[model samples]
Target: MSTPVTASADALHRAATRKAMLRLIPLMCLIYLLSYLDRTNVSIAKSQLAIDLGLSAAAYGFGAGIFFLSYALLEVPSNLAAHRFGPRRWIVRIAITWGALSAAMMFVRGETSFYVMRMLLGAAEAGLFPALMYMITLWFAQEDRSIAVGWVYTAPALALLIGNPVGGALMQLDGSFGLHGWQWMFLAEGVPSILVGVLLWFKLPERPHDARWLSKQEADLLTARAVSSGTGGGHDASRITLAMLKQALLKPFVTLIGAIYFFNQIAFIGLIFFTPAIVQQMHVKTPLLVGALSSAIGVGSVIGVLGVPRIQRWLQRDCLLLGLLTFGLIAGSVLFLLVPTLVVRIALLAILAFFGKGVLTLYWTIAMGRMQGFGAAAGLAFINMLGLIGAFVGPYAYGLAESATGKASSGFFVAILASVLGLVLVPLLPAALRRADAEASQSQRTSARVMTADSPVV
Candidate 1:
């Protein structure tokens, strides 16, 4: 009777743990979806905003791209703060602020107002991804980290998949409630993030210890698993000084990861910011259809994100990256050179989205595996800072090139260059990090063997 009861209780506990993770996924997805939507809505709004504000293509591109400049500068400090204060408090705060700023776009009139609001939005959102990464470090073991990271990443794809169509519909809602279509788009998209922030404050547990849904035993097991996997212990809460920052900046693996992230962003942000316009160039005048097609890239991203963990395990990290980078380069090249049909171009874009996002998953997984010590958080923050710089530069660079060449194909050529750079850089990272990982695994095995030999049998 006692054994049966114990088994039943164990099953109940397991169910509860599963329930907690399940509850957390949608909320996480929602947060990421909104973040991407808010960040890229400016791209969707570019057509109408450009005409209404009397801005040139370059001016509109600059306005759209400048958000990441402030975002890049503030990322490290904001993430460090999340590390020190705990994610629950800081994430909610950042989300709410960014959400309000996003909605505030409705009030912008001229170029100055647009630029100011964009910068404000960037500053407000600086903490979100870094904080999410830090939170994952706390809650998940290393083995589980990539899949978890992939899920959060799936948001960008989903956002791209959904945002354009939604933005188009809302934009068409102009004159409803005394708002322009663009204003309506901003308001509809931005308001939900604030509400999500409030909900996150209530639903997100600060740590395993605070998760009421988990039994004490289950939490201990989870933490122990994390510690055993080479994370979740000795996370120093000391503020990062200039010297510490320099050390993080100087690490070979960190710098390599940043380069990979930067190059990847160059391709990604370029495509995202310009996709609607690209479709427009293909003679697709229907903004709603363009939006839906653009969103399909996100759908491709979902498949990539879900599929990458298995692919990583099979090919190993570096190999997986090389393959994906190759795929992106080839797909991008074909899209640039061969495909002229709108349907074919859209299909190719979806393929690019699939492979491009897959490459990113591999890059991030490798970075997390190599990132060690208290400075790991800072390393990630700095990577993001550099990556956002690429994000800022990529779109604007493409727009400027378009302005000069009077053709969109110039942007695709730039993307091919970035993708090739990623292919070259990814191969170099394994010698620096993979060798260390191998040595560490050997050391751990030797330690375990000695300990096993010395243990007395009961």
Candidate 2:
């Protein structure tokens, strides 16, 4: 009787743990969905906003792209701040502030106001992704992390799929609720994030220690696993100083990875920021339909993010990336140069997007695998910082190239160039890391077997 009761209680606890983790996935996805919606709504808004405000294409492009400037500057510090105060406070604060600023777009009648609001949006959102990444580090083990990260990261793509059409539809409503369609677009998309922010304040567990669903034994096991993995989480004043920053910045591996991400972002951001406009150039009858077609990329991204981790598990990590990069080069070239038919172009764009964004999962996994201690967060921050520089350049360069050539096709060539550059850089990474990863896997399997053999019966 006693043994049966104990087994039942253990099962109940396991179920509860699973339930808690499952709940977090949707909430995190929703949070990121809103974040992307708020960030990229400006792109869709540009359709009506430029005409309404009498702004030039270059000025509009500048305003749309400048959000990353403040975001890049504050990312590391903001991540550290989130680590210090805990996600519950900082994440909620970020959400509320960005949400309100987004809603404030209703009053902007000129380019200056647009630029100011965008910068404010950037400052407000600076900490979000890094903080979320930190949160994932806390909740998940290293082996489980890539898939979890992929799901959270897929939210932006999902938002693009949903938000573009929604924004386009809202923009069609010229004067609803005593505001223009663009104003309504901002209000509708932005206000929900604030509400979700409040909900997150109540819902998010700050750490495993605080998670009611986790048994004391489970929490202790988690902390022990982290320590053994060399990612233990006590606040260390020593790690936050300038010396640590200098060391992280100076590491050759770190710099190489950062450079890789920088070039990768040029292609990624170019596709995302300009896709709708490109689709429009194909002479789609309605802006809303074009927005929906643009969303095909997001659908492809979701498939990529979910699929890459399993691919990495089957193929060696480096080999998987090599294949992805090859696919990217081929698909991107077709999208840019060969396919003249609109339907074929859209299908090929979807294929390119699926593989292109899928590679990011592997990129992040490789970076995290290389780091130790405080270096994990610092390294991720550096890569993102470098990536944002490319993010800033990609859109504006595409716009400028489009204007210069008087053809939208010119932008695709730039994307193709970036994809080819990424393919060239992948081989430069250390081959030994791949071998080391394989050995680590073997050791982990042996340990798991021994642990299973040694556990005592109730």
Candidate 3:
């Protein structure tokens, strides 16, 4: 009888996990793909935007970077709102507002309007990633967390891989309604997010318990997993207190995660904002060709994000994998500077994408493992907010380098230096995270004992 029960439980777990993945991951991927494209499509539009607005490289960079300022500032609050209101409604709100703001880019007629619109768009999109991370924590178990994150993260790479060419093609509609190609791209891309946000209202559940598609057994199993994993399903997951927030903020691992992410974004965001310019500097003149080549180079990011699970098995250590990735970023940046051939340059960018974007899942998985409940919600947002300040710095620094030197490749110096700084910090992650995990386990154990003692006897 006991054996039968054990077998039954195992079968249910497997079936439920499969269903959860099917219902959630693809939609999550689609949402992120749209989100990423809306934010970074400015890159493909840079040349024309600059010409029309009479903006220099530095000014354009400043405007692009300003988005992150508003984004980072509002990230924690936005996430807290999502945590309180339920991600189902909050995420929809974020999506619709951001989509509208993004579409409004079509109306920016000057540098000032450009900066203002970009910042508004940033504010609207703030906390979307952390909210999604929080949702994943509520849904996935510890062992499967990284794999789920990898799949969701692949969407950004896919956004670049697919959206680039689509954007270039849409740009061809520049004069269709007397709007510029860039304007057309913005309007076309932004509308989908709004439609998708509405669809999510009907499709997405507030929590595992609320999932109508899941059988009672599956929902119970998932909720049990969430509670045991400290991901928050019961009373403990309810409200984040002042002490909890303070404690999370003071953790060394949290600080380290923020620092490492900051440095990494300097390279990753720099690449996103400058890749087309870098390609154009390589003498790829046409917008269509530039988009095609940029998309081709983005293939490495897709490979890197999708390969995390297998790569984790091969590496057997997140720290080691992280070290290797950062080193790869450094090597690729150095080579991109040394190599003048167009093919080699594109290849180096691909390599950079591999290492730069690949590190995201590894680091996020590590961070998420140590957080649970509303703490996970607030903590993820805080770390993301702190780290993304570098996103601002990255574009502005690269733009300054480009403007000062009149050379696109000169901007790579920022990437190289930032990656090296991140590498130096990699050695600290293991110890910090280990300490955090141990503390979290002890707290979970204590909570379990308290709940067990309070339970009514069968």
Candidate 4:
């Protein structure tokens, strides 16, 4: 069915796509790596910082979790604003300001200052994920976005893999310049974001049309693909209203996906926030030793992040991916709960990270399937904002449990319970997405009829 000219054009299209991905993805991945590291490096600092700052278990947990409270509150508005202004300016602002706040964390003398800084940090970083994804839509066609996102989501896995050891090493910098090692870590890690933010102002492009790196032929192909892929509901960025955003959030499909995200993130956040201390309790005293042990989760997660997309394609069904992730979560939880030994617990934690991160990473694919334009963009922000509420609740609850029991085991059980809850929610998605698609179709037809009625006869 293909002629020589058509085949040549197809080959050219593939080459351009590859080139665009190579040029754009590395910097983006680095940015996302910093985002995760800046937020979660506190995990490595947990024990030392708590002692240095005289914070109780509960107070520390609340401060750590408070970041998500502000994140949830501002995520939707921030994402919408980023959509309006363009990713180049908005993402840069987010990075630099968040970096400043993260660097300012060295000033925490007590709980009040700690809480204030964490809140400020959350406010600064809100909508970062959605804004980045919005930029992906501008740069890559829809069909290619999954692969692009798959690569980008690797940042968190790599952050954990690299950040844990580096943060551990930084934790050893205790007498340098009269600052605590944790303080050194904060200042050192925070500078990269500031540097990268400045670079983004010049390096990042707002749209494909604006990318000087893209050739004319390549740009023409991307333009055609972008228009075709955007035919559903994505093209008109300006017409996005508050009502549409509200509707998108309230939709049953969004709610269903939100529920799955909520439960998984509770376990994910709680585990990441508390794991360093938990591993330290297993006779691992030094920061580097504890960090290396805890990095098992990261190892499993990287494998899951890189391999799950191919697995999903092989399985050829969305439901299978959801089901597999749910099973992994439940199984990992139950195994860890049953075995009280340290080695088994560590292994089980890897299993949890593998499935949990994979599920969380790939879920956007299903959620974004029916979404096209402004509504989809805002909807993603709202859903992620909703998920952050769970992140806030999970760590706070685990900290309370740990505080009450005076043991890390109790806090870990809370994570297991959160994972168990996913079984109930994962089965609800296929039907909800279908119903949402049907409603969207009906609304489009209704709009067409109204427009026809308003038009003059030819």
Q: In candidate 3, what are the lDDT values of residues 1-458, reduced to their tens digit?
A: 69999889878887888899999988888888899999999988889988877878888888888889899999988998888888889889989999999999999998899999999999999989998888898887777788889999899999988777888788878788688999999999999999999998888887788898998989888777766676764224355677877876678888888888899998888888888889988889888888889885569899989886679867779889988988998888989888899898888888889888888998778887777776788779988997779899999998999999998677789998999999999999889988888987797799899999999999
Model 2 off-target regions past 4 Å? 1-20, 233-235, 319-323, 326-330, 431-458
Best TM-score among the predictions, by candidate number: 3
Candidate 4: stretches off by over 4 Å: 1-9, 230-239, 440-458
lDDT tens digits by residue: candidate 4, 1-458:
56998888778778888988897888788888999999888889889877888887788788888999999899988988887777779999999999998998888888899899999999999988888877776666667777887888889888888888899999999988899999999999998999999998888877767889888888778766655565233535577766777776788887877777887788788778888877887788999888888887888778778777777777768766887887787777777767879888888878788897877756776676666667667878878987898888877887898899877656767766777786677778778877877886897799899999999998
- Output the lDDT of residue 170, model 4: 93
Estimated TM-score per prediction?
A: 0.90, 0.87, 0.95, 0.93
Q: What digit string (tens of lDDT, one per residue) describes model 1 on residues 1-458? A: 79998787556545544554576667787898899999999877777887888766677777778899899999988888887888789989988999999999999998999889999999999978877876666666676778778888888878888899998788778788788889988888899999999999999887778888787877775666556656565346775577877875677777887887788788778778887887777776776877877776777788878777767777665654555665565576566567677777777787788787766666566666655445656777888898999888888887887788866556787788887777787677767686657866896799899999999999
Q: How many Å off is the CA of 215 in candidate 3?
A: 0.4
Error of 1 at 83 (Å): 0.5
Against the reference, the lDDT scores of all candidates come to 0.78, 0.74, 0.86, 0.81
| Candidate 3: stretches off by over 4 Å | 1-3, 233-239, 444-458
Deviation from native of the Cα of residue 254 in model 2, angstroms: 2.2
Per TM-score, what order, best first?
A: 3, 4, 1, 2
Q: Lowest-lDDT window of 10 residues in candidate 3?
A: 231-240
* Cα lDDT tens digits for candidate 2, 204-236: 887778877777866765555545554554337
Task: Give the C-alpha lDDT of model 2.
Answer: 0.74
Taking all chains together, the TM-score of candidate 1 against the true structure is 0.90
Q: Which candidate should be chosen as best, given lDDT against the real structure?
A: 3
